[model samples]
Target: MIYKYFKECKKLIVLITLLGMLIGMLFFITKDTPPTLVLKKKKINIEYGQTYYANFKGLVDTTGMSKKEICYLKKNVSITDNLQNEDQKSYPAVGKYKIFIKYNNKLSTIQIICKDTLAPVLAFPKNVDVIKESDLESIDFKSLIIATDLSPLKEIQIDTSQIDIHRIGEYQVKVFVEDIYKNRREKEFKVNVTENKQETTNSQNNQENNVNKIESENNKPNEDITISQSNEKNNVKDHLDNGHQQTKPPQMVYWYECYLCGLYVDSNVSLEDAKKKFDQTKCTDAIEFSGIEWRHSRFHYGINHS
Candidate 1:
């Protein structure tokens, strides 16, 4: 009986020892710690041409390791900070980049985004002149605009709705442009529409008519020179030799000037009929005035010019 009791006691002692070892293993695991690093900022932003430095102010856990242990861990860790490439150092292009930080078998990330906030430089013309009937395609719009932007230019828009190319007047042309980042710029310029050749000719004719009217009043003949129709026919041949004859015989037509445009209109029909004919055809700009002067050419019937 004593022998059997001693065997049972031995088994009980072995069970207590195994239980104590299991508890000790659990305590050792609980006391173990992990290396850690905490960062104050994980993301940063900067301008395209601004300077950047790779720096981190954070807490690093060295709970159960010495400086040598940490140094060894750092050697195994890989750090890649490609914020500034070779090209970026010279000319920084706007973009986003990531910094990879790996230490103590742990991974952390940093984000950097570059932006362009400055306004673009502009070189624009102050004024431009174009004829009223000028063609739009003939204008070199691109050459007139000189602009530079940090961000790429997306598009340029021109607004010419207020300018009438068919009318003689001053108008405004607005130019607008935008960058890739939605940065916008605008400029305005004056556009002058000048008269065409036909209009210039009309102005010159008006001046001549004014001069002729003043001369006719100043030089009144002392007596009217009478010549018979048969005698006039005989002198017609003589007038032709003196370059005082009409190359094409004059037709019996009403000759007058448009009061609105001051352009002379001559027709074989009556004054009213001439106005209607000009209205039906685009003989000149749409007439705004109806007053007409009944006049005849001074060169008619071989009247020599002084």
Candidate 2:
């Protein structure tokens, strides 16, 4: 009986010791200690050139083992954190990057992908001209513009209703090609508009001057003699043989400045009753007028000039 009692006591003592060891192991691992680290990102979906936040959700530490290193392999980044807090993520390139968050010996890793699959496009030329009076009623002018972005460009509108320019201006517009990824590239200056007619106010002024000049010439030279068609041929031939070019030839007088055509040099005779002084001669060979300018020339007929 005594021996059996002793054996039972020994077994009981051994069992107690084993249970104590198991309990002690538990205390060593779970007691007064930071658990493990759990790092989380605020969003899984993000765009290129976009921002995302990372947060440390759970962590436990007793011996300052909570200090962790964060790293991204693709972007050559390294960061250190002391608590379960926020994290920053950036997609600077086009590819997948592995993200790592490690607490001393414990670690968690994820993949981040950056992508670009879009092309940039031209936007607009809205109002070509600002106001009507600023430009000639017959002249063409400049336009205003706008630009925008949609997944792809659907339409671009240009207002040309006011343009009277015969020539069209060339303008470039951007067009985009897009994919599921929001990444973008640019193809600049792809559309154009050009004005068809070259406009010049100076030219129109010359025409007006020519008309006024012709009328004034009719009034001033009324005192001069008109050559009879019958005698004019011989007289002209005779004059030419004498090496005398007609003084009143349209070439010699700027038509745009003409104000004395049929008038005699005496300046006293009336044009309706005028008689010839240079009947066998020619009119003034050269003209000098005040503040005068010439416009243009045209082909001459045997008797009249255009």
Candidate 3:
């Protein structure tokens, strides 16, 4: 009976030893195997003004990983890029950048291409007026526009192909602008070209005629009827001494006179009438009249009241 019991114990011990060896081999075979890192994509595209996250979740999957391995990856994963504000999640500028993700001594790379899809902004008037036969070279088109963009401007072109300075008609003008990123913007406005009438010539001529008439009156001789004039003056003095008060005529009051339009008006003229005359004339909107001053020599020309 003792011999039989020893034999069974020896067989049981051998079976247990073989089972332990198999388990050891399995552990050794799988010990150095790395955890799989499944990535959704290896490349990402973001706009110029978009934000990028440092700890972007769902980009890598941690499924089938042990609790310890997942914790290690979460703690050890790091992302590096050329962004200035990497901690703030905003892209610095528009360019292509390579992002390095490292976890557990393994590195993964992703390409980020920052692109600009927005166009430039333009602000300009809808209607413009140009004088006929104007000097086109003196006109500064840039001063009349306001352009804005995130990138530097590449070009600003004014298309005045339809405009004719010598012609009296309306034309369409276009302004085209572009940025460094190939973003473009276009704006259009109407330019009116009108007849260039010599409006100030008539006023100047009228003033010259009035001056000549005044000079002639001042230089006129008093030899025609001197005795009759003296008698009339004596009679007027006698009438004044007799306590007869002679009423004086009201003084003429001139308000404004536009040299450009030959519009001469007194205080009796309404403001609306002056505006109508201004509109009817070929004078520019900048022309206006101010307080008048009298001179014995020449007329005071009106100035620009814009």
Candidate 4:
């Protein structure tokens, strides 16, 4: 019986040794292996104020990755940048940046460029009246233009080829501006070369003299009193015989002023019709008329009657 027990113990030892070897082989075969990471793009450009995501699928290639490995990488990937904030989706300012991405002990780098694509905004009057013979070269074109941009301006150019300072006419002036990021914008306005100062003053004085002469004539008293009194008596007798007095027709006049050219116009049409006529008769694209005023006068001093 003792000999039989010894043989059984030896068999038990051999079985236990085989079982341990099988367990060790299974553990070695099932161990996890590191994945190979490949960067698809090394440089990325994002517009100003654009949102950035932490997704690496577009920037990285993971062809043979299983669903579980992908999920693991998504949860464990890290991104670091100089301008990036933990709670922000984009950079705070416009400039060049470097982004570092790390996943599963593999490190990669990429360039993130924040670019400004919006053009500058320019604000100025649509019409500018410059006197004839004025020194156009002495004018500061930059000071007259109000430009707003997200970045510093590279250059501001004024195209005055269409303008003739020596002549009295309307001309177009264009302004072209560009930012540091190569964003460009252009705007145009009218430059009216008005009459010389001396000529304008002489014309105004002559107009004033004519107006004074008309006023004097209206205020003058009748010269032949006896004839005037006889005609007045006859007119009263005729009116009494007719049993009714004749009434003069009502006259309606509308007055409008051109804000751009500083010219006044008198019209016999309604106010709305007068405005429409004035707009239709505008010679320049920048000429704008003010609101019309109703008047009963047949003659205006500085107004062009129509």
lDDT winner: 4
Score each candidate by Cα lDDT: 0.54, 0.33, 0.56, 0.58
TM-scores for the candidates: 0.41, 0.29, 0.49, 0.47
For model 1, the superposed segments whose C-alpha errors exceed 4 Å read 1-38, 56-80, 86-92, 100-107, 116-120, 180-182, 196-306
Clashing residue pair totals per candidate (backbone < 3 A): 0, 36, 0, 0
147: Cα error in model 2, Å = 3.3
Best TM-score among the predictions, by candidate number: 3
Regions more than 4 Å wrong, model 4: 1-40, 48-53, 56-66, 84-95, 116-119, 138-141, 181-186, 196-306
Score candidate 4 by lDDT. Answer: 0.58
TM-score, structure 3 vs. true: 0.49
- Residue range 1-306, candidate 1, lDDT tens digits: 999999999999999999999999998875464334544467767665443444321223445666765665455555466776335243246888877778766788888787877555445545555556666554655555655554578667788788788888878888888887777888887766654444556476567768886545464333212212223221111123333221333233544354434555556544344444433333243322113222211111111111
Ranking by TM-score: 3, 4, 1, 2
Error of 1 at 287 (Å): 78
- The list of candidate 2 runs beyond 4 A from truth reads 30-45, 57-98, 105-109, 116-145, 149-306
lDDT of 3 at 148: 57
Can you write out model 4's per-residue Cα lDDT over 1-306, one digit (the tens) per residue?
999999999999999999999999988865565445677788888766443443455565777888876666657777666656223322346777777888777778888887778787666555555556656776555555666554678768999889888887878889999998889999997766665444555576668768886544444332321112223221211111333232222344555465444445566654434444444443332412122232211111211221
Candidates 2 and 3, the one with greater TM-score: 3
> lDDT score of model 3?
0.56
Candidate 2: lDDT of 113?
Answer: 56
